[model samples]
Target: MKKDIFIPKVENVYIAVVNEYNEIYNSQDWNAYIINNKDVDLEMVLIVTSGYNEGKITSTFRKKLERLPAKNYAKIELMQEELFALNNTFKVSFFEGNTMYDKTFLFRKNTINLKALQPIPLMDVKGVLVK
Candidate 1:
């Protein structure tokens, strides 16, 4: 029989993806801040923390560092109304030209700008696989 890993789940957690220089690239639904480009092309660290107690929970993404040494990551910033976007789902595609990304890039929300936006940029994509 396999033993289960006793990982505790917490609410209101904060996640930030930083480079080796500690520049904030990506973050969770909240707390997204602008990052300096000088911190790019360094090791990427994904930090997951507990919200209620304010403690670190898990760290992942070292594998990505070994693969793409000079790659940059960006965190999505959520505005006051943009907080709703965290719960939404969207699709991605590789279509190009005037008909660029027609079918598979539909966003879930019905807001004006949100309705016609693609979450992830498709151009110059190296890898699209989720860990």
Candidate 2:
């Protein structure tokens, strides 16, 4: 008897949102305004849910980011330099407050310790964590 092999589709481009706490967010929440635009043409936008700041998510700029597409849609851009340079384990920092935000992140042995980001920053929102 012969068996068939299964292959998974490759995701060429990925829109990574620099969210906090590794939570999942729906793009529609912030991108609804641009959905009806006539000049938006982006595949996906990862809403990196940066931890909240003053009751709002930090750097939650899906509106601006989604408007970058030609069809008036924007997508999260991921550079090879950043992704490729990252090891199996690494830390990412994200800001939480205003006026020169500061925070710390560390990854080791393919594991991320969430506690390090207690007092997050205002920028540098890293993408969601995937195991």
Candidate 3:
């Protein structure tokens, strides 16, 4: 038998993939969003790790986000270029009332729709594996 690891519910803020309008959506290009659902403002740092297939390369995208008002969200980066985008890991760190919060969101290749809009696109990186 395998035991399951429990992840406590993290309130106040979270990171997710959204559209240009900052809503949960799927599009030709998706953006990472830091959603502040609390009553107070939030300061955070979002680090996005993108892995490429060609040349077995991995790159990091960093954004220092600050003063995100309540009920608002900040768009971080435009990703998954409707082509050979492999996977992404979003690492978010923030503080609320002296309590620090950190979480990671993993978006695997299976979550992506390869045929987003029109004809096929090209992958900048070539031989990277999804796993």
lDDT: worst 10-residue window of model 1: 59-68
Query: Where does model 2 exceed 4 Å of error?
Result: 12-110, 114-124
| lDDT tens digits by residue: candidate 2, 1-131 | 23574333212112222323313643322111111122323333323322222333223332233213442323333222222223222112211122111122212222223232222122234443332
Error of 2 at 54 (Å): 39
- lDDT score of model 2? 0.26
Q: What is the lDDT of candidate 1?
A: 0.25
Ranking by lDDT: 3, 2, 1
- Candidate 1 TM-score, true structure as reference: 0.19
Each prediction's TM-score against the native?
A: 0.19, 0.17, 0.60
Instruction: Estimate candidate 3's RMSD in Å.
Output: 10.1
Residues 2-30, candidate 1, lDDT per residue (tens digit)? 46744232211112211122247543222
Q: How many collisions between residues are there in candidate 1?
A: 2
Candidate 2 vs candidate 3: the TM-score winner is: 3
lDDT string for model 3 (88-113, tens) is 66677776666666777666654544
